[model samples]
Target: MPKSKNKFGKYLLIFWGLFITPFLLLIIIMFMASKGWIGEQLPSFEELENPKSNLASEVISSDQNVLGKYYVENRTNIHYYDLSQNVVNALKATEDIRFEDHSGIDPKGLLRAVFRAGKAGGGSTITQQLAKNLFHEKPDTKTERVIQKLQEWIIAIQLERRYTKEEIIAMYLNTVEFSSNAYGIKSASRTYFNQTPDSLSVQEAAVLIGMLQAPTRFNPARNPDRALARRNIVLSQMNKYDFISDEHIDSIIALPIELNFQVEDHNFGLATYFRESLRNDLLKWCKEHINNATGKPYNLYTDGLKIYTTIDSRMQRYAEEAMREHMTEIQKKFTEHWKNKEPWEDHREILEEGKKRSDRYIRMKAAGASTKQIDSAFAAKTKMQLFSWKGDIDTIISPMDSIKYFKKMLQLGFMSMEPQSGYIRAWVGGNDYRYFQYDHVKEGKRQVGSTFKPFLYTLAMQEGYSPCYKIPNIRVTFDLPTGDQWSPVNADGKYGGMLTLKEGLAESVNAISAYLMKQFGPQAMIEIARKMGITSPIDPVPAICLGTPDVSVFEMVGAYSTFANKGVWTQPIYLTRIEDKNGNILQEFVPRKVEAISEETAYLMLSLMQGVVQFGTGGRLRGQYKLGMPIAGKTGTTQNQSDGWFMGITPELVSGCWVGCEDRLVHFRTLELGQGARTAMPIWALYMQKLYADKSLNLYKGDFEAPKDPLNVILDCDKYVQPGDNKTSFDRDF
Candidate 1:
């Protein structure tokens, strides 16, 4: 009996060695692989602790709204709490039914996957899937693939040990791709439903979870039918797992995937132009500033920065709406103004010049095409989407005609800023950013027209000239260095009356402006303008006072803000602060302040400009819009009515607007429809009206504040004013 027992024990030892030895060997191999001691490289322990992800940098508005993002992957991470219970449950039910019970790997599912050769399931737990994504690489050989699978299992176990189940799931959701350039659940939720992750409904959660299987095949926006079917499958799984009741799932699957789809794109959204402009600025800033942790320059696209800007979402909406409203009206009138005759017909040279500047022409030229070939390309009709006031128009048109169409179409730039802080509240760079890539606010340099007068007038105020300073409306000729005479032509060509300086500016009298220009030569005008924040080069020609030089809307707005800011030129700034991914404040920006003029001079200029809105060219602000606020403004109409500009100021805000065709040659024949007061001022009025209606903004409606000290200079012309006592005081009397 002892011999028989010994034989059985020997046989048992043999059986244990036959099975357990290879299993232990496999375990050892996997352990070595996890430690990077085997077939394929795996993430190190530290790397596993914090997985790499390409996160988008966000642009947040002053109201805490996300204006847009700069990204290679449009991803923003959220903690476990930011995800709704619906998403969590849906994930577990569909992807891993025994998620809570498993420690990285499930024994039954793994055995099923092995014996059935993955026909039943891949048996990849959520943690394993996350491990694959965290350290993704392609295997060239089947042997490498098998080793990679082993490495994934070991890495999954490590992740499970290092993090809680909730953290594992959160990381999985945060790093997964959801198509449409949207990586991670937060961006997916906002891109599909325009909602936060925590606000997703059960159906929405199910839809997003279903997309994880195959993002493109089940994209809600692109493949709604497949997405709906997949979503129902997820819901059915939820019912099987008892996460959702049978009755609940029946109703849930019956519901279609209702998506408010908006692709996360730099060319689409609230502030496309501003985001593009900020991207350029941030690129420079990143080069200048380095990241302390990595000892490298910051990456604007991948570093996951939070740029807090001064833009107000509400105000941006209003500004965009105002542009669309007024631009449509003026464009229609302009079309009718030159109904039969093209504005550029007499100057086909201008058309030829513009045609050469086109992308088609440039491409053809680069391809070594002859001039005739380039012309042929332009004249060839193709399917294209043209920008229109109503909406984008899909049509078959020649590229040349497309250019002409856009050339005839109007473009504009509008911006509003807080004068005291120089915080930009709203900026609309063009009619449509996708079609017109130029940013008129910062990048575009065009004739400012009569908007340039403020700088000269500022000099007049500094030289002790009061608002009541009078001059005759006569042709003031300048003796040119070329031995010729130069004189400005008034629109009406009527010059006789003696008008006050305030009246002359309000009326935008060319002769009076030329008279002032002669007194203070172009040199002094340039000096005052530079001090007022005009960065553009100013020509010292006498014609500069007539707005001949080109300047940007950004410079104009910043220069005009000096008056409202009580003579301090606060540089217009967009960003308030920048933060890292972890919400650590990296840098804060403050507006640069410079004393451009005296408080008294600024006040006097305000009084003179106020007459513009009260009775001069900008009188439409009072008559048409009936804006009750005490406003100071100027109206500018460039040569041939090519460009129209309105510079307006209130106590709290300084706003500017410019309207023109793409080519300076394309313009209205009549000043009535194209003048600054008619074209540009209407937009400002409409924007201000909306701003005032929204009482939450609390824009100042009161009159401009006077100087703190006693006024040494006079504004009242009727008083014993040296300029126009009226022989009585117009400044005080008004």
Candidate 2:
């Protein structure tokens, strides 16, 4: 019996040793991993606790320190507020009521979570979650998650020691991503509900808070039913937790979810393009600044830098609405034609069919359809397929119906600056940022068309050509450097025999402009353009009289603003101030001014442009929208109708509009459709009407005084003198 007992005890001891050895090894390995003594050393608590060491310093500026930029709200039409009390309360009820009381991890919740997870549990407090969101690096594996959780706990404790309860909540609200693109509650409130956080109702707040649990699954915009269910659960939790009264919960549940389709501060239309262009410019500035100092790339998006822009939120919304309305009208007209031919049965489907037919034709052409030959019998059948055929064989039908097609075409930008301060008031790059990111106002280098005529005429006035100087309007052609002949023609292709300088300008007479260009010389015109702030290339050819110089709407607006500002040219700037996150002033853009044109010369040009609008191609604008204020503008159309442009200005604002295909193809089907007065003037007029609807503007009715003769101001023009004594020549000219 004693021998049997000893053998049994040895067997039991062996079995126990086998079972406990692996567990003991596992514990030692876990301890080593936790202490970062394993294969690759993991980050320690000391490293994770110091968020500032890892954080990049963000540059912020005070409102006064920024230059050439405006502190426009995300959406100016609506007001914005920080996280509301109700929103905070709802979040507490739904997420963690003990958020303030708990440490980095909740003990009871961790216990329950551990039981549920078995081996993959996360025991994070609200503070821990905030810390993870704000500072923790992204992790993909279970082990990595555990490491991140540990780091998160260390960071959370540090945060608790540094910030108060309310400040932590505020930071979480500002930092948490409620949706895919939405980074914070402020953005989410504006995006989903189109309301300020403070303005959100109980139900709306609950719905938004519920989205924190699972954004994609309960996105109110995409899944309203799921969102409602989630919201109800949140509301029930709120009631259970006594965060809100039962009656309040019932009322919240009864209330329907109302969505505002118009998102605030969304920067619809050309704002996106302008914003992107501005972003690129800003990035370049940042990179250049960094390159000069540290030779490193600075990421503007992730750097948490506050970017103040020059976009006028109101103007942006109006521009977007106008484009949408115009496109809709065009579509409606096209649809009406189709409807009149056939009763409406599904216009979209019919439109799709038309598109398919067009695509097929294009494909056939691309595949060398022109080379194919067909017998007469086969040709007839092929025609029937190519074009829809009627029941009567005599009447050939078209295979494709013509559906209305309105190209998503829009290019409009504005650069408004205070005449004295040079602060840019507003700017829009284009109609849709998604389609085109180039800022036509700032970067688009197209033929100024007729918009450059004013600068030439202004130069003429400055160089001794009176507004009343007689210039023959006879037909004239010039030889190009490439051995090609170029003849400028009027809009009607008719030459007016004799015209005064003022008459030539008012009528946009190409022959008279070309004649003046010859008299004044090309170099003089180029110099005038340069003085007027046209930075683009100017070909000193006769065509320059008709505005063939390549320039941007931004430059054009700034040049015209010289006329508005009584001859002082101010560079457009948007930001007024910039500060650091710690409220230190970083930069300030001071307004600067340069005199480009004399007050008298500017007034003369303004008068001529006003006449052009009143009696020339832009007459329609004056007739349609009886602008109460005295406004001056010029309309321009390029050859083959490839580009249409307009630059208009009031004493208070200067705006430019251009319309054409990006590919530079002929746009209009006919001459009636080709003019800038037809394409761009209407958009400008509409924008002006909206801008000056209720505002009172002072009108300038003063006349421009003309010089006595062209010889008085001619610079070193001894070559043009008649062969006579100097005294005799001067006396004769006078």
Candidate 3:
């Protein structure tokens, strides 16, 4: 009996040893991991102070509006103060309920997760999740997962020791990826709601908090039903935790998820073309200028440089609004006129041009794709998003057919600038940036038509010609350097009499323009235009007087602004300054100025252009908009009614606009529907009407300043008698 008792005792002792030995070994391994003795090297204190996350550089408007950002992660850090209480409560209720009670690792939650196989709740606290987000990459294997879990625990404890709960939460929100290229709460808020985090309501906060689980699966814009259900679940959790009242939950849940989805992509935001152009400028600036902290060139993708531009948000809005308003009506008229006829003169040529411009064509060419395959791809119908006057629509269409549709659609470019300072105030590059990547305001070069006549008239004034300078309004033959006879006829086809330069220009008599060009010569005119900021290559030809040279709206506005600035031409300045992330000034931009023409000559030219708005083709400014300001402008119509241009100037502002199809071959059949007065002038009038109404804009409504010295030009024809007539001829030229 003694031997049997000893054996039983030995068996019991062995059983106790077997159970306790493995538990002791597990404790030792965990302790080693906690002290950085196991797995990968953890982030040190210095690393924790400055986390490795991509920061976006911002483009801010002059009015302090955040235009957009350039980033790899699309992340912008916000302080704890920027977060609303509702967002905090929603995050706490959905992510970690006992967040305030835990010291980073919640033992109670861990045991609960173990009992329920992670179905009831997650064991990792906010700090642990933040630790995983900040310090560790996602593990691939089961063994790697175990090691990562140990690392998370250690890092969570370190985080608890280093920062407060609020700071940890803000840091967590700032570092977590919300999918769709959005990183951090600030970016997520802007991406989903088009508003800041501080402006988020309880329902909005709940929606964002719910997205934390699976951003792609529950994206509010894409999956409204799933997003709504998840948001309601978050709301219920908040209600159960007393974060919100039951009555509030009931009311909030009833409301549908409203998403103002404005994509902040490179081609989606306001002034997208302008922003794209500015990015190139910044890229060059960064390469030239070195960062103070790193002693290296700034990376626009990573460095949080703040680009302060001269664009006014209000004026930009007005410009876009006016374009949409007038272009829609103008397009309707054009479509009606071409109901039976094909819009393009050479559809095949336009299609080939469009195919050359396509990315697929370029890539396929690079990859050595066969001609048949390329043609098949272009002809095949595929899903696409198309821009309409109403709104964007999704449809299935062939790429070639889409290009044809775009060619039929009339597009426009409008830009406004300060005459004196050269600051570009408003820029509308095209009808839509997504559909049209070509920036007409800066890149497009179409025939200026009668708009170029003003430059010739400016040359005339410099050569001692006046507003009252009489010229024959008859067909004139110019002996060209090419040894060809160049004779121009009037648009009205009525020639034979004398008219003042002002009357000829106002009526846009083509014969008079050619006669003046014959007399003054194109070389002198090109020199004056060059000094006035026309950067395009102008040919010294007789036909150039009839506005044959193709010029961009950017160059036209710069030249027109010279007249507005009392003859001092200042090159258009887009960027005002660039500051580093730490508010250190890196560079400041100044206007490039040159004396293009005399003050008296510029004012005399203004006197001639004012005749156009008052009594000639641009009378729509007075008839339609009733803008009674001291406004001077010109209307242009290229041959075959391809391009329509309007350049309007006031005491403070000068705006230039162009309206036409993507391809010059596609145009209205007649002057009734295709004239500059009908197409581009209305956009200028509408934009100016909006500008005049907005008192905050402070745009001068007064007339152009007269020359400081008395000019020997006849500006008003109220009492002047013609040199050959006994009675003053009151008959207008047109």
Q: What's the residue-level lDDT of 578 in candidate 3? A: 90
TM-score of 2: 0.72
**What residue pairs are clashing in model 1?**
716-731, 717-730, 717-731, 718-728, 718-729, 718-730, 719-728, 719-729
TM-score for all predictions?
0.94, 0.72, 0.87
Tell me the tens digit of each residue's lDDT in model 2 across 568-615: 888876655544333455456665678888776776677778777777
**Candidate 3 TM-score versus the reference:** 0.87
Worst 10 residues of 1 by lDDT: 725-734
lDDT of the candidates, in the order given: 0.88, 0.62, 0.86
Q: Using lDDT, give the best candidate's number.
A: 1
Query: Looking at model 3, which ten-residue stretch has the lowest summed lDDT?
Result: 725-734
User: Which candidate gets the maximum TM-score versus the true structure?
Assistant: 1
Report the candidate with higher TM-score, 1 versus 3.
1
Q: Candidates 2 and 3: which is better by TM-score?
A: 3
Report the lDDT tens digits of candidate 3 across residue range 529-570: 899998898888888898899899999999999998889999
How far off is residue 629 in model 1, in Å? 1.5
- lDDT of predicted model 2: 0.62
In candidate 1, what are the lDDT values of residues 43-113, reduced to their tens digit? 77778776888889999999999999988899998999999999999999999989999889877677667
